[model samples]
Target: MEKRVHRPTAWHVTHWSSDPFSLGAYSALLPGGTPQHRTALGQVLHERLVIAGEACNAGAPAMTHGAWNDGLRAAEAALSAGARKVIVIGAGCAGLAAAQRLRAEGIDCTVLEARGRTGGRTHTVELGGVKADEGAAWLQHFAENPLAAVALQHGLACIETDFSCPLAAASDGDLPDVDAAWIALTKRLDRRLTLAEAINRYMVTLEPAHARATQFAIDANLVLEACLPVERLSVSALDEEGVGYGDRMLPGGYSELVDLLAKRLDIRLNTPVMRIDWSSTGVKVNDEVCDFCICTVPVGVLKALHFTPALPETQQQALAHLGMGKLEKVILQFDGRWWPYSRSGYLRWYDQPASWGEWLDLTDAVGKPTIAGLIAADAIERQFSGRTDEQIAMAATEALQAWAAAIRPTP
Candidate 1:
């Protein structure tokens, strides 16, 4: 077995949770929250002010496609109400989509983005020499995802990723069974419970050995998929979300779709709208006033923006109930492929249970020597608390080397 640790040629890390414009990676429901909160946020106020984004998209919250669809819906609502001039806030997928719809219908629309760049959470950057998504990368539930059709339309190659396969470093036990146990527990719940509370209840029913394995198995997907830590996630939240086996990725990066949506649209980047003052007659976003305003900012960062007259009671409650997901990523580019090219397309390193749970191999997917490691749940807190980007890279590197040493050791 190779004892030497291989350092990366280049590395990139994401701190979505700390970004002032984002606050977190994605949207989720808190312990006492429900889908009705998302519905309430999507409701238009005064027939001239509309709010749209993934958080407002109950059918497919936390996905870019959901944001796109909601953006379109918001624009349609404003147009149907005879809106002429419009302001769409946040130049992410939702903002761009809403602007695109308005422009097509000949409604004068302008998009204001807080950052210098567009794409919101769907950022794409270089992780070595390869083009990769710094934020979202997957077209989850691809069979039903609009991104699949959009990718094909744009001539971008979409590859299916089967998550069931894993190049495990001695898995504790059948993970799916443990996953089933979680699903079963959700059904018999008599009251609202945080994920952490429910897990403790389940742990008492198992032997010490089995309990450890169960912990490893459940932790594998809990925060990694939901993006929220156990304490923040509601047990009932899973019941509202859609789960399926179909998944796909865009090798050219998700920004390609964003570009297509943003084409010919008037977007003012780096221009943050600090305050939104709206009335029954018109809407004022900062100094610019318009017939209507569509705010597509992430729910996590909404509280920072001042709204004159305050939002409706329902919107306020929804904001309080919704949560931001804590998932972060560390994409490393190596001189060569040091890890085993497993049929699973991913790895589960049980040896480094706490820090490293799952990793996606992108060598085959992106045709480069790259691997993407996830930071979620408590790992986001433990690993990123006071670490620099270099330090974060180092920590993730240590976990990666441990996996390589065990699975594809050099002779």
Candidate 2:
């Protein structure tokens, strides 16, 4: 068994999502907005400029296909304008998708990116000579997800995975005893969904004003995860749609997905958009102007970036009110699966039960011995803040050990 500690060398990323110009990898919405807001945001302004991203699609928001569809929708608006030339912003999945749609319609478009590469947040790195995804890992629920169809249409290969796991919660030493926790969590989730469904049915029978008042109650508890309370999410948030916990993984990585989507498009890289001057004749990037503009940048970036003619106070207020929280995942490698537990993918620990460091065991796709550790925002912040690699590894190992001990009895 060979144990190796992996660390980022020079921040090793080619995805423009992390670039200051882009601000975020993709769009995610918070609470307080209706489906109408999403529609209004995507509308083409006077056949000159339009906005598109995951946020535009109330049904498919926050997924790759959501952005893809949004791009096509925007391109259709541009194509109808009778404009020969158009400017596509951000070469991520959405931007590339828009450009492709416009090109197919025989419309001339130029893609501008802030970073030297495309595929916004979808990037990959060679870890132990195997591709590892740095962004957008899963094609959650491929049955209904449009990305799978798109990937297949583009001749990109995808790996269907059986992501079922032996455990669900945190572990102490090797793997935690998550039966009780799982049961509890499942019960709460089921109840929440049932309640939500009931509310939906009732809303159909109620008057408009009454239905609107009841929606707040239904939205509050649809999701089981406490970190992201479903109540604080948009009322139009999509249901689970039959994708639970884990699903298919892209072995070739998100970068491959991006590469597949970026075919036959004129993408200008390393040209960071400092300001979007939309008040004048058309949108301007780096002082260059164009006929029409399609913005695929994340909402966080839109809120952060300075807009010429200044964004309307209402839009600015919406941007400020609706925002995404921080999420981080830390991948840890092991010499051998010294997990000391007889489980496959997941572990749950509850030493203090603070929800600080919930982790999963990501082994090699071929069932070889390797580990990809995960930690979210609060958990990662609690333990990994300003820590060295060695320190992080030790801390992680110790946490795993405690988790395993909690779940299983000592021999």
Candidate 3:
């Protein structure tokens, strides 16, 4: 790549894939979700109730912009008939944005949030003396993210991160020394990714029927081996979306974006909406009757909550059909760097010899002690599930030592 242009001097990285609240970073469609599910999920109920999320926008779903677009479309739908009253649940990116837009369009809207603070999965926490994004970090498709423009309008800072850096091996010590083979595998994966982008672009021009079927096929091929399949994904949802390009890091913290959106909105913290009575013209929330209601809770939470009057069997089935991805990010602050031969700022340790799973260095944060994090949702769940923090840490240290030996770099 240097042959084509000058390389940058610095970079940053993060691992939100494993956060408990997030389970996995963003929403992903599984093998069971059909177009009918997404369509049903978003279908306006008697011009009254509408669901919107990254999950709603099949094409751009699981992205910040997708959430924004969903909110806007929902608001537009609500206001089309000059509806005067509206209620929005969840104060995260989607809910807040929906309220703001509805307010702008002269529709009366209120934002309700279950957490004490807004920004559901998008959260920032203090770690090692610096504010870090504990949840969603990357601001994807910046050019289209209304939140990005909002960030700029508010003078919030943003940083760019490159995605082509080398990935480290996570295989266990006993696993055959497949570093070279793994590198080749990584290159092959990159090529396949490029191919996917081109094909997706081409998919845009095809007829809806053709495009939907093709996308389902492509998703099936791309779904991770151990994870859910893509045939369950909603093809109709991906049809109307356009490609988004700008991707950047929120230097201050992505959670701050959620906070910014939450300002001036009516939010109730720790007030998880346990049930929704949607059987009548007005929905009931914990015995309170409201003119309208919008639920932006994660599907997981929604699936667990008891619904009064019960959802339509089809809707319940749709909820049951969707799958949640599991990811875990375990951060360990070290007194100093360990690995030698630092060609790349980030390192990847894979196919671990021990039970700790894959590890990586969070080498480029703004502050101290050279923090590194390990991630392997399945492994973490298997070895550390219900185990004490000490057990998890000890397991991690052993894994790190093995990774150090793999590169054979001076401590």
Candidate 4:
């Protein structure tokens, strides 16, 4: 590398995978699991208890809007179950959305959040003198997403983004055929296969250059989109999520929407429900009893929490089959815009141990010279193992410098 990347004045790093409240960045179905696993987890228990989240939403699992929709439906279902009072767990999108609906309906509801703040994974804090949504920032499938309109109502502007790959100058001419082969293989398969296995089996059949391209596509797109490492992702989920990118983001931060939905709702912060005891007529969340319970905690947290009398075998199996994505971020806020402003839209793909390959253009969102590198899938464990936050950030910065040197050479 000919050029050196300038040091940032400030930075932030996330460890959602290690956060006990989250236990993961989000949820993923295991290799052998199907959408039915989500259906099972979403199933209402004893007619008075329900588990809701993106993982429970089979239609759009592992998305903010999916979790939002899940909450709305969960509230309605709880009402139909003859519940007078409800206890919603987690303060994230789904729980807040559920509580919001209950508030509008004039129902008695209380939200228990383990964290001191609301917005669960949708956290936003000031960095570089601007707001940065630490967890989610995009409103994907905006045309039909309910939150898209709601964001405008909250006075949050929707910044339209280009999903088209901006990193590479030209599209791989052979890529479409390679993707088609992946689609065909996933669709025609009768058995279970991890994404890594499928990729390996398929890549072996391709020419050397095409095989390299295959890895690039997986690292550059699928892994980032899934927010999980290749080895843990299910082939079925890869097929189901298809190919989609966030077309818009809220420069004001996604937490604005969470706050809007949480308005006037009874939310108890720093309250964690370690055990949920439920029967035919009522549910006990820790020490408090409610007529109904909507457990919206992530699958990772749900797996660890205790349940009196035990959850049904089917639901237990569903929880076991569910996987969590190890999504971590390293954000660098430089004193000045030393990097190419034009390269903001151009994307880069990095392999494990390479550090900070997926650089996000936060130049517009953060209103400063900021770049966010995403570490997902198995790479997260590798990056975090025996490394401090400062060390991780430096490695990411070095990767950025290397990329800059490659793109803009110096004498």
Evaluate model 1: give its TM-score: 0.93
Candidate 4 ranges beyond 4 A from true positions: 169-194, 242-246, 342-346, 352-354
Task: Assess candidate 4 and give its lDDT.
Answer: 0.76
- Cα lDDT of model 3 by residue, 142-247, tens digit: 8777778888888887765443343444332332323333233323332223343445455666676444444333322233211223233333223323223446
Alpha-carbon local distance difference test for all models: 0.81, 0.59, 0.56, 0.76
Q: How do the residues 1-411 of candidate 4 rate in per-residue lDDT, one tens digit apiece? A: 534446778888888988989988888877677889998988888788889999998887877888999999999998888788999998888998899888888889999999999988888777768877778767878877888879877678887666554553112232233354445545544444556766677767777765555565566556766767666767666655622455687777887788787889899999988999885467889889999999999988898888877899989989887977778888788877676554335456444343454666788666787777777776766777888888888877876776665555466
Q: Could you tell me which residue pairs clash in candidate 4?
A: 166-346, 167-347, 229-377
User: Distance from true position, residue 220, model 1, in Å?
Assistant: 2.1
Candidate 2, residues 48-70, lDDT tens digits: the string is 78878876776666667778889
TM-score (all chains, Cα) for each model: 0.93, 0.74, 0.72, 0.91
lDDT by residue for model 1 (279-395), tens:
548999999889999999998788788998799999999899898888888998888887778775778766334676778888987778998888786778888888898888888
Better of 3 and 4 by lDDT: 4
lDDT of 1: 0.81
Candidate order, TM-score descending: 1, 4, 2, 3
TM-score of 3: 0.72
Cα error, residue 28 of model 1, in Å, equals 1.2
| Model 2 stretches astray by more than 4 angstroms | 1-28, 153-157, 161-166, 170-246, 340-368
